[model samples]
Target: PNLLPEQVTGTRIVSQGRRESDYNLIGLTDPRGNKYYWIGPQHEGELLRHDDTDYHAIGDGAVSVTPLHVDLTHEGALKSLREAFG
Candidate 1:
């Protein structure tokens, strides 16, 4: 099937795994004196951060394809770790 640019648009793939923490913890105590901590994902730069997926998916009207598996390993440290601990 033939497709046109106007009909189907390809968008930039937004990379995930932002090292910068984007969550917050709310500490509270119940009536029974039991302390509890609630962790939730904050709406941090949802549509403003360039590397964020929502930025392109929601802001831009295009197909946003996110990889199922992304390698977040620090390749630069591999050589040093190998030499030191090999």
Candidate 2:
């Protein structure tokens, strides 16, 4: 989805990291007809941060393929807590 400056007039997602406010391109495609959501901050600096696990491999000139998981919670911790409580 293309976000225009006029479209995000009152939203907090406006580009504040750049010198001039401009919309950055972000896209997602579902080739297999599965539902997915892609949410993250856009790169706005001259040098990319190495701490981002999502796109760090891409920054190093390597092909990155990240597998998506339905649940994002820490399952190990959850299982331990469940066993302790019950």
Residue-level error in angstroms, candidate 2, position 40: 9.3
Residue lDDT tens for model 2, 1-86: 13454443231212112122234555566998776665544544354334434344434443344554477899999999999998
Per-residue lDDT value at 4 in model 1: 53
lDDT of 1 by residue, 1-86 (tens): 03456754556676643435468898999999999998976655443456557445534555666677769888889988999999
Which candidate achieves the best lDDT against the true structure? 1
Q: Which stretches of model 2 miss by more than 4 angstroms?
A: 1-52, 72-86
lDDT score for candidate 1 against the true structure: 0.63
Top TM-score hit: 1
* Clash totals in order: 0, 0
The models' CA-based lDDT, in order, is 0.63, 0.47
